[model samples]
Target: MSAPTLYELDPADSGIYRAQMVTLTDKNPYAASVYVYDEDEYRTMRLLVTDDGKAGVALKGDEIVSVFAHKDCAHPKSVQSMLSQATALGGRRLDCFDTVLPDLYADAGFVPVARLRWNDDYAPDGWDYETFRTYNGGRPDVVFMAYDPDRVGGDYTPGVGEYVEDYDDGIARAQRYRPS
Candidate 1:
């Protein structure tokens, strides 16, 4: 089998990259891990941080290897289209969001889901545990992946304001994969 392609959002992390890493650790002091990958055998890793102050990078031994670039990350329009297709297949994509205007989300075909923390083991923070563990399971840490959905025909970038003007929309399906 062929080797996997090394993917990244930001290849040159440099000073800014380290800062983002520190933020993750600081945010979750009790449980933290850094992801590091082998760049020699595979390609280099690049990572991109989203506007939401979160980047979808896995935890490795010491640091997260850069593998994905935000500049190329799927646009909001693509993600929304993908979600609409999934709905026809009886599949659901759940997303948790803040600061989104309720009406705008509704226009974009999104419904809110609870912010749940599912297990006691992950809920070391008593209050956080109690607050989120309304259901049976728990996963304190989660990652949201980049949007690179498959389109029906060849790639098509809509005209500026085309989507909003043509379709009543606001949010993107990418939010469905957002980390809780």
Candidate 2:
């Protein structure tokens, strides 16, 4: 097969991406949110999109290598593409949270960061853990790999807040991940 092409999606493309996210969530119930941001916002925040068009938030600081991609696009190339973009943008640390895509991220250089488990405490009302655990029995683990923007080697760093915003407690709880 030919190599898949990567494109930076426009905001107007949210409908298609959101639909894909829904499909992913159906397959992995622990997924509570799948967000996509416009290029302007993405750039301002140092985020990136993968070849399959999954959005990622870029985390910079303490070596500058962290990204959060939506839990779809279980392809290694997609993670690599995001890493490439992050590197091009001068980032050094890369992170993603898709257990299905860990191998891909690993091959590209990300190591397992932490295993994430969710319950009703992290979900909204009407959400069901039994259903979620059934859907994603293994649950998803956070994976991270370090990249050096100044050099040509990949390193690993732990404990950096890549996806934390001071939203309401409920909102914060919903978006919480290992702060590294």
Candidate 3:
């Protein structure tokens, strides 16, 4: 089999692509609808379509901020292709919360700078990371990663660590902590 083609959908045909995405993929309805209704956001959407699957991504400036795909279409190749296209188009950072894609992102040269887990008690004042629930009402831990390792710092290195609850404090500690 061949790799699916990933491309930017024409703004004029967003509605058509939106419908196809909804019916053909198991993407989150609420997330996919944003592109369908928001004209400006639709311009940043990238889509992957093949005989057997579909995938979508929404870019926030140079960051590939959101991604949704049909279950069958979320293969490594499709996701990798999307990352390659993002890099070619100047994507520099991404925060991956999904359990599966973080590995793929790491393989694409994005280094994990911090890992976050929700803890209402330890969370900082006015912290809303836990409040932004997914469509299924779950808050998966977020992994803050950067495509350019230099963006974090010269001393920062990639290594596994325990999940941190306080976003600000966690990031500061994570940057200084190196796993054994």
Candidate 4:
């Protein structure tokens, strides 16, 4: 099958917006409508494929597919193609929260940097802090992983321990700086 064509959905495109809303809702009920709405506001990108005789979103590329599949699909050539397309028109970085994609991104020459922690003030009511910590304490949810376009063809060696050590150093530094 031909790969689904990618398109940047305009925020004003109600049909695409609604389709994405429906897709997000069906796939992830826990996600708030505001999440989709906000994503539309900022990064309006989607991959469309015909499913059940209707246009629907699919994994943008094999990397995303492998992420969903929870396995490694290291297609270096495919990664290069997607990276080229993404960066051709001035792309920043590919942002994804799925754990599986981090390794693939690393293999594709993207460096896995420190994960982001959402402050407590930003969390919604009824959000499970303990559960969240248990599930993602060591491995944070929002990780900034990216490949340098200049060195796309080279192998990437990820510093897995760096994230942990950095977190510890940050905590120690903050404690030391705190007023006693």
Best by TM-score: 3
lDDT of 4 at 153: 49
User: Compared with the true structure, what per-residue lDDT tens digits does model 1 show for residues 1-84?
Assistant: 111222233445434545555554454432222332334312242233344323333222222233222323334333333233
What would the per-residue lDDT of candidate 4 be over residues 44-162, giving only the tens digit for each residue?
44433222213323233222221111012223124434444454543434434433455656554555444445445545444444544543552334444444555454443433422
- lDDT tens per residue, model 2, 1-180: 122344544555544544544555555454443333343433434333455555443533322322344544445435466555555655544444443444444444444333343333444434444654533553333434444234233433433224332223322332332324
Taken over the whole model, the C-alpha lDDT of each candidate is 0.30, 0.42, 0.52, 0.38
lDDT of 3 by residue, 1-180 (tens): 224566666666556556654464344423322223254455555543443436655556656644555656645446656665676676666665534456767766666766776444543333334344541134455666667533322222334435665666444553443323
Candidate 4's TM-score reads 0.45
After best superposition, candidate 4 residue 22: deviation in angstroms? Answer: 4.5
Error of 4 at 72 (Å): 20
Provide the global lDDT of candidate 1 against the true structure: 0.30
Candidate 1 lDDT trough over 10 residues, lowest sum: 159-168
Q: What's the count of clashing pairs in each model shown?
A: 25, 7, 0, 1
* Per-model TM-score versus the true fold: 0.24, 0.40, 0.52, 0.45
Per-candidate alpha-carbon RMSD to the true structure: 15.3, 8.3, 8.4, 10.1
The list of candidate 2 runs beyond 4 A from truth reads: 1-43, 46-79, 94-98, 114-119, 124-180
State which candidate, 1 or 3, has the greater TM-score.
Answer: 3
The better-scoring model by lDDT among 1 and 4 is: 4
